[model samples]
Target chain A: MSSSSNGNGTPILELSDVHTYYGSIHALKGISIEVHDGEIVTLLGANGAGKSTTLRSINGLNRPRQGKISFQGRDITTVAAHEIVKRGIAQSPEGRRLFPRMSVIENLEMGAFQRSDRSEIRGDMDRVFELFPRLHERRNQKAGTMSGGEQQMCAIGRALMARPKLLLLDEPSLGLAPIFVERIFDIIKQINDQGTSILLVEQNALMALDAADRGYVLETGRIVLADKAAALKTNEQVRKTYLGET
Target chain B: MAADASVPTLANRLQRPSVVGLLGVVVVGGAAALLLKNLTVAPSRFFEVTLIGLTTGCVYALVALGYTLVYGILELINFAHGDVFMLGGMFTITYSTHFFGLHHGQGPATILIVFATLVLAMLSCGLINATIEFIAYRPLRGAPRLAPLITAIGVSFIIQDIGLAWKGPNYITAPDVFPHSRVFSFHGVDYGWNKLIVVVITIPVLLGLLWLVQQTRQGKAMRATAQDKDAAAIMGINVNRTISFTFLIAGALAGAAGLCYSLYVTTVRFDQGFQLGLIAFTAAVLGGIGNLPGAVLGAVLIGLIQTWNEGLPWHMPGSDWTQSIVFSILILILVFRPEGLLGERTPEGG
Candidate 1:
């Protein structure tokens, strides 16, 4: 956490003293973190740990009651959800949230909703279909009818269609088999390799730590630990609790 | 760039015939059979029925667009929209008869006045519908699907009661401003100018709306929001505003249709929207609830069926059976082709 603020490489996104509440129950409390440009930052925690809240807060879906969220050197704390997206932030929300009744091609088209350049949109669609050939094969098929792994691929492809500088993924590996999980993680790495900074939220700590450059551990609405992924992966407490070590 | 390399595969998939192709075949085949049949029906009666049907169909399409647009975005039934359309016609009649003191066959000036009044009535209906969305529907959003639906029905009954209180269940005679004249004859068929006016006016309005949805930036935003609200919001679309705009447009179309019905038919009442709304709802479902062109096609088909049902001789169905027949056909269509004629199942994660 200390190494996150060297001024040499300014953070792409920063959240300070953030708080969020759902009705009367507090969801995220006094959470602070920084994500540098081009970094793979993973937030790992158990269920109800506020990992999703942190990501949603950035996009203004769940606005923090008190805090500052700065993205690319601009304060986005009070910005509307849709406007936040225009500023080059995109989220592949939990549960995929795909329009189940629309065609695969139509789903991808929606990804570029804010963009006006027709040619660029076409180009982005082409790029997405390339990454997931299954999506290409089923371009006319309804996304809800696809298999879990394929749907996850479509979700990722849909996010990429936005061509965002920062992509937030909430539980991309949920409800997936082991092989599909490995494949999804590989694709995530590939997407990050292509220069899109990522903020991944997952309960699958082992895999997330393996893929992330740095990691944060949250528990009961607070950040309990933050460190380099390599160090966190070997940390005694993390190993015993999250990594299933004997 | 990595994703672009797989274009050939997607192109191949897109080229395959979808459900839309099958529906086209059925519709075309049915229409051809109807045209090809040279029945012994009376020519005069057939012409009259066709004219009436076309006018009725145009009105149905106008009302159905409201259902389709609202359903396209919110997926809500908007049971109250029909009453709103009825109120629009009532308002037009009130203004033309009571306020302006306009009467039947007064000249082209009266025609111009009627048109102006009709436009104002439609605009007012649009504003009312927008207000309804803001006040009633907006609060119930994200609660549950049934909550808004129930609220819509409640609103429908409330409007109906208001109309009953205002007009007292009496049939109001709409002022006939246009001169009653048969404009021309085509192959022994007399063409009335009023019928021509309705078609000419309606065609352009429908085309304009279609263009607005397909060609304009607002149209793109609408489609985007319809497909996925969160994604649209993510892309900088204000979901609430878009939904409100949709309601306004739908309301205006229905209002204009009501005005046209009042002028063309010569009578209007509080309960007119109830029957017309049901017909339009059926048309929307028949064509595909959210598809634009589908609604128009369904309306025209319904119009034709209704006319033929009444006019065709040699043991054809009675007028009394029209509602039952239309609904029965609707059920069949749903059972066999749930997506409607031109509609497709929307994709997930749009």
Candidate 2:
């Protein structure tokens, strides 16, 4: 991971020791992470390892009881969830929580809810359609009725409509066919190439490590390993536990 | 947008030979027969009754739309909405009688005063409904579904009591300001200016609301929030504010209904909102609770059914059975198809 001292300046998103709880359960315990201006940072973990929880803390859905979070160097530790999106952060949340009754175009329009520039929104819609041609074909289809891969594509496409500076994607390839998985990863890379930083949470370690520039291995609410994606991919413990290597 | 060919469509489901479906067909067919018989026997009386039904349905549609709007966003029945409608009528009565001293036969001046009263009542009720949401609903949002539902019922009683205190036990009457002159006539059945006035105002408001919800940016936000609050928030939509705005719109609709009922019916009591509210609620449910057009359709259908039963000449159940018939339809709907006529049949726990 590129630190501030390495001439990268302040990271676009920085979390310092964020603690989050789900009632009595300590979901995220003093976890700190960073994503620079144009890098894809992936958080890889087993179930209950707080990977999703960390993203939740950063996005303001699950407010951290302890620690500071900043985007573009502005304090947003206690900001409301909707305000987080207004500050150029958007999430294709877990389970692809698309509005079931709404058509695909309607869902995309919803992504630009905070935006005021009416004419520019159409351009963004076209850009999203360009990215996912499958979505374009099914633009009138209800989000819930689509197949899993299509729904995931729609979810990512919906997030992109926000024109976010930092896109928080939770398991973009959780339940997709192999072909869709590859296509999604390629789009993720293309999205990064266009200058939006990303914080990706994924259980698919191999695919996530491949797409990400830097990788963090989270275990039981704390980040255990933080290194370049290449290095983490070759790490002995990561290979064994996460990659399913016997 | 098309469902897979193998998947049974709504038409197919309706045609499927289930007991509920069979019963529905029989009931609908029987009602159709009765309606046809009544129409053939007394064409002019039927048309007059139909006009009256349509006018009453417009009022119920306004109130039913309120119930549907709140229910669409929050999935809460918002029992107090009827009381809000009641208060709207009271507001209209107060403004027309005391503020404007509006009486019959004032010509164009009366029109201006009535219009002003309509605006004031709508604004007042909208603010009140929003306030009710802020106080009663917002705090219990994270609580279980029953918490908010119970609170809504409680709020309904509170609003009713407030109405009771404001107008006393007696019926608050509005001046007979709406002209009784016939707009059009056929076979001695005159469509009066009062009835025409109700239709003229209602159609525009309903259409405007449809445009707002379907076409506008804020409407998109509202729909997104209704579908999924968390996902909507992630997309930069303010869920709470959207919910509050929904209540505001719903309350405004009830207020308009109140004004119409006061002017056309000319008499509104404090507890009337509760009875009317239930009928409207039933209308909303019948049309498919969360669906906008569905509520209006259900309201109109119920209005027609009520009037037809009372006004028709041949083997009619009459006015005394209106409550029983309406409630029975509600019960049957709940038992057979909770999704209602226009609602999508979402699998339970899906």
Candidate 3:
């Protein structure tokens, strides 16, 4: 199934025939996808399905050996990971990837490292606090000292501090408690509503589908399915393989 | 819960004597006895030695700070750090005597000459260190951790060889440019201006560095990078440039220490870096290798111990045992209090 690319404006990010490798292992074999402005696109896959690899390739952490990645209509395939963030794209990354020693506020400040807007940055900090009040309570506490769910909040807040036009979130719900998983999905939908594009990766098919506008099913470095999220939620193969509804 | 209560707490475990406990007792007990024995005689001498120790300790602290800073970011020891310190000293000596024609007791010119040498040495060493990071370490970043470490040692040797060619094997005398006025005199023990000058420069350099690493935006990037390099990049921090900045700051510190040692100790030798560098490295490890303040504390402790052992009126071991004692402290700290005095022992985050 092909997800309808209707009504949405120009593509904010597009990957064409992207193939990425890790040493001898070919992780992403010629996968193509696009995320339009102001839409949520979820990449659905199991472990080792190259979902994270796709995000990594887009962010230039693992540059695609063979293909082009364009963001906002400019080629970013060879850009450095840090430079990619400066180009209106940010990733919260796998495992939260927090600076364990830094406080939550400092972690947020780091997300805005490339930006020099002091008052505006402070305003965003307040906005983040409003979004995740638990972070406000522990703003001075080290990221490592926080609970896993709180650390996950800090991670998302950090990426938001960049004020990116497009945010790549990898496994945002991974290892979170079920309650937190629900809250995270809620925040993802809320964030998408605020005009920022999102490319989300998740193993929680039901929650991802509930929040995303479009979905792609990946297995062993290839996309086997792409469709509207409603279609994916009801698709026979998605239900049997990922939704645990055989 | 009752059964769990029966398990020994850390304090209870210590109460039951083991081989490790006995070793700790022997080491602490021996050190206390030696210190007590020395303090009982010629207390004035002890006071004098302490004043002298603090001055020299400041020098060690400057160099030790370099090691800890680089280690904090990269986890690489930057073994070449000491040679950079050595070259800083060489630069100080050359720029002062050869370039400026500075001599002993030149009044106001002494201050100007010394300041000039400080800036020149610091800037040159900073660039050299940054270059070293760009050339030797960056390429090996993807290799095993040991690769960078080995390359550090190799870079250290190359710098040492350059120093050897610059000034040969002999100890080169540095012209005393600092004023020799006495800061204070009591019971015929006077603290001179020469010692005061070293401390004056060292305190601000250390405090400035602490501020940079703790308070500034750049400092936040550094701490973040140190904690997680990949994560720092994800946050839009230029990790490569941050690493280079760390090296530059560390190199400037080496330059500051170089200038201090040249003026106060009054000599520079090509092979001196290996000896002093090892001592500073010992200081770094004893204070917890990657900790900043711990590095300074450890350096002072080592400096005091060395001075006391050599200068005490009691059964002193003399200056020859200084290296052995300092290195023994390194081994003992590794075996016992490896986290260092001021450092927190963090469990591996992963």
| Number of the predicted model whose DockQ against the real structure is largest | 2
How far does residue B16 in candidate 1 sit from its true spot (Å)? 26
Among residues 3 or more apart in sequence or in different chains, the pairs in candidate 2 whose N, CA or C atoms overlap within 3 Å are none
- Model 3 lDDT tens row, A1-246: 122343276688999999999778999999999899878899999899999999999888898999999999999999998898999998898989888877898889999999977889999999999999999999999787788899899999999999999999999998999999999988887787788889999988888888888889999999999998989898999999988986
TM-score of chain A of each: 0.95, 0.96, 0.96
TM-score of chain B of each: 0.87, 0.94, 0.93
Residues B122-239, candidate 2, lDDT per residue (tens digit)?
A: 9999999999999999999989999999999999999999988888999878888877889999787999999999998899989999999998877888888887888888888788
Looking at candidate 2 chain B, the ten consecutive residues that score lowest on lDDT are B1-10
Against the native complex, each candidate's DockQ, computed on alpha carbons, is: 0.30, 0.60, 0.50
Ranking by TM-score: 3, 2, 1
> How high is the lDDT of residue A32 in model 3?
93
Candidates arranged by lDDT, highest first: 2, 3, 1
Clashes of each: 15, 0, 0
Q: Which structure is stronger by lDDT: 1 or 3?
A: 3
Docking class of 3: medium
Residue-by-residue lDDT tens digits, candidate 3, B1-350: 01124543343445667888888889879878977877777767878898899998999999999999898888888889999999989999999899999998788878888888899999999999999999999999889999999999999999999999989999998997777778998666888989999998899889999999999988988888888888888778888999999999999999999999988999998878878988998998888888999899999988888898889878877888888899988887766666667665563211
Across residues B82-136, which tens digit of lDDT does each residue of candidate 1 receive? Answer: 9999988888888778877888667777767777777788798899899999998
Candidates in order have lDDT scores of: 0.82, 0.89, 0.88
Q: Kindly give the stretch of ten consecutive residues in candidate 1 chain B with the minimal lDDT sum.
A: B1-10
lDDT of 2 at B39: 89
Clashes of 1: 15
